[model samples]
Target: MKFEFADRVNRLPPYLFAEIEKQIKEKKAQGVDLISLSIGDPDLPPPPFVVEALKEEVANVKNHNYSFSQGEPDFRQAVAEWYKKRFNVDIAQDQVVALLGSKEGIANAARAFVNPGDRVLVPDPAYPVYANGSTILCDGEAVPMPLLEENGFKPDFDAIKAKKAKMMFLNYPNNPTSATVDKKFLKEAVEFARDNNIILCYDNAYSEVSYDGYKAPSILEVDGAMDVAIEFSSLSKTFNITGDRIAFAVGNKQLVGGLTKIKSQVDSGPPVYTQKVAVKALAAYKSAEPPEFLKKNNQILSERRDTLVECLGDVGFPCEKPKATFYVWVNCKGDSMEFAAKLLSVGVAVTPGVGFGKHGEGYARITFTQPKERIIEASERIRKLFK
Candidate 1:
């Protein structure tokens, strides 16, 4: 019997990371030693407290059962308290929902709100999941808003005001671009959402990963944000527990409930043990200052960012030293994919700009998640290759 894939699945865009992984495997098979600065997975371990908390929770038989669909009560309260402490914003337990990861929450938020043919506004050169998860997977229309260079890779909100959209996705400490938004911009975003009656999905996953004393602002810090926006945050990037899959969606009770309804139909909820671990992690964070291990990770990432920027500059690839996130966006000038292939062949892997979106064309992104030594080595290889 012949089986046809669903139309939605048929039209799915190729995942960029998969292609990068394929090339990496091919090179490894041929015995080429590759330094991968392409993927953004954090190289640090979760703090000792996080591990101990998980271990302690695993011993409790109660934590082995199915958790609440919204979130465990303790976990939700922890999130609320953490938000109050970190961002000086008031969030209620009722407005919080547990997620497998911020990625899952992002995709599900689109699924919950988007109807077929409804328009979704998205920034180009963004995390693919934002546009793809909202528009393609949900059978919605994608209105591509270019992230202009002059605007520092932020979409022109004024130009988009006339466009009718059911949802709009924004990220800061932005991925691919590595730009962070100020509170004024966030206040403007909240105003835009309120005026347009659009649901604002703010991805704040990299909020904890800033550099050079730069602090990323939470959208909830803006006035009226809770009335118009939902913020997604993750311990994956924050505490280096990417594999642990613990995150939460906070704000707008209705949207939180909508996502909860969709989640109930799809699966039970986040793993009980993981939710327990998350409760501990959030409590530990809000209770005091960041641990030395977490601070050291930021310091190391900052040094790596500086090294890559300087090295790339010496090789004629001028990059603005990113203030946040682990990625450094570079202009490759011509045929980003071709240049990426050339770099890959030389055992240095980087993401092609075009792989992100049309706006990302002629640019490439490198991750600072690699060790400083490896990043320096990749930069040296790039310098030698280009020279």
Candidate 2:
């Protein structure tokens, strides 16, 4: 017998990373030495201290049981403290909710607040979860806010056509685009959301991944943000702990409580052992400076980013070196999908800009997640094909 998927599931565009994974597998099966620069999964391991902490936490029998739906108290308090120390933003423990990952929290937050007919302002060429995993799954209409190059890959707030969008998602140290924004821009975004009576969802997953002394800010750092915005941040990218499924949503108690309620019905919070480890991870933030491990990790990624950008420029696909994130957004000047496929033929796999959204059509995103030597090798492969 055949089965029909629910409308929500059916509405999702083909998951971009899933399709990329399949292509990578097919290429490997053909005995091609493929170098995948498609997905954002980090090749680095979590700091040794994090690993050691996890090992100790798992041995405690209490950690094996179910945690509070919101989160363990210790973990929530750690989140609150970290916000103060890192962003100079004050938040209470009650305003924090642990997440399996920011991805799950984003989708569940949509479910908590968005009504079937509500409109959500989403940036084009964004991480697909904003539109696909979140808004569309809630039967909400996703209004595109194009992130154009002329505007530094940020959405032009005045151009938004939606008169009454219920929500808006924004990311900095952005995925796919690698765009960075200042606190001033975030303040404007907060004002825009407040003026429009829209709920703002800021994804700060790449907050710790920066280079050239650039630091990312929390939306809550803006004065009025606490009233209108909720931010999702992850240890996944920051601490190279993606597999641990640790992240949180902070700011706006109502928003955090609503998401926590949804999570209570659907699943338990993140694993107790992981939260315990994450607490230690967050506690490492003593002052404004990042932990030594994170600094070292960013250094490796910075070197790789430089090598890849230089190689791409040499091959005639000129792109700017982003000050944050491990991605380089290249202007391929043609059909991004075809350009990506052409590179794949040369054993270098990149994410086609079209997979992100229509505006991503003429671009391609290259990640420097691999070792520096591997990045150089991939660049040589692209140069051989393009130059």
Candidate 3:
């Protein structure tokens, strides 16, 4: 007998990054020296204190056992405290649901909230996980809320209201687009969610990776937001703990409870040692000033963004300089996948925007995750190809 596949799993568009990885492997096999600007995985190391804490916790036999499903109390408290300090929003430990990573929380949140055939509002050119999680796992429909350059990549309230979706996914210092929502936009979104009886799922993974004196605001900062919003944050990008799989969801108690309940049935909490280390990470993050290394890193990437913009302009593929995050959402002159493939042939790896959504057609997402010298080299190579 042949094995059967579930319809939902079969219906998901090919996992974009996996396809990129395959192409990367093929190119490497062909002896191509690829300069990868495809994914946003950070290249930085976690703070030294975090590493030391992990070592200490691993040495303690007590930490070898399973942690609580909702995570270690200290970890939850630290997350709550960090949110209070960072966003100035008071949240209780019960309001926090620690996750192995925000991605898992996002998927589990959809499973918890979305019923079959429910409409989920996701931004166009948004994070792919939002739609995939809703559609593939929750049996929901994703109604794309078009995000355009004209609107500063912010969702149009009227359009979203028309959809009347049960849940809306909002990401700022946004992935792919690198668009940051201002306080006004966040307030408007909160009001919209409340008025529409919608659950606002805010992905704030890049909240701490900002530059240009612009701080990313949490949707929870808006008044009454906690009544209707749940914000997911990750130490992945912020503290360079991507491999640690430590993140949290904080907001409405009921929503957090729903997620926690689902999580309890599915898996045990993140490793006890990881949570112990996370406590130290959060504490260090609270007291530590921005280090000179990150300052220089951001400056270098900022310059790379400018250089990339100029280079693309010279090649007639102009793009707006993004204010935060490491991605540049480029409007490809024609088909996104074709352009990406062409670039890849030349040993440059960029993510095709169409892989994000239909609204992402004719665009590509270029990440500045590569080293500065490689970024400059990639820009030159891309310029030569286009010119």
For model 2, what is the alpha-carbon lDDT of residue 333? 93
**Which one wins on lDDT?**
2
* lDDT of each candidate versus the true structure: 0.88, 0.93, 0.85
List pairs with backbone clashes in candidate 3.
Answer: none
Model 3 / residue 358 / CA error / Å: 0.7
Tens-digit lDDT string for candidate 3 (294-348): 5665776788778777888789887878888989898897899999999998899
Query: Which candidate's TM-score is highest?
Result: 2
Worst 10 residues of 2 by lDDT: 155-164
What value does the lDDT take at residue 387 in candidate 3? 77
User: What TM-score does candidate 1 get on C-alpha atoms?
Assistant: 0.97
**What lDDT would candidate 1 get against the real structure?**
0.88
TM-score of each: 0.97, 0.99, 0.95
What ranking emerges by lDDT with the best candidate at the front?
2, 1, 3
Candidate 2: clashing residue pairs, number: 0
- Residue-pair clashes per prediction, in order, are 0, 0, 0
Give the 10-residue window scoring lowest on summed lDDT in candidate 3.
285-294
1 versus 2: better lDDT goes to: 2
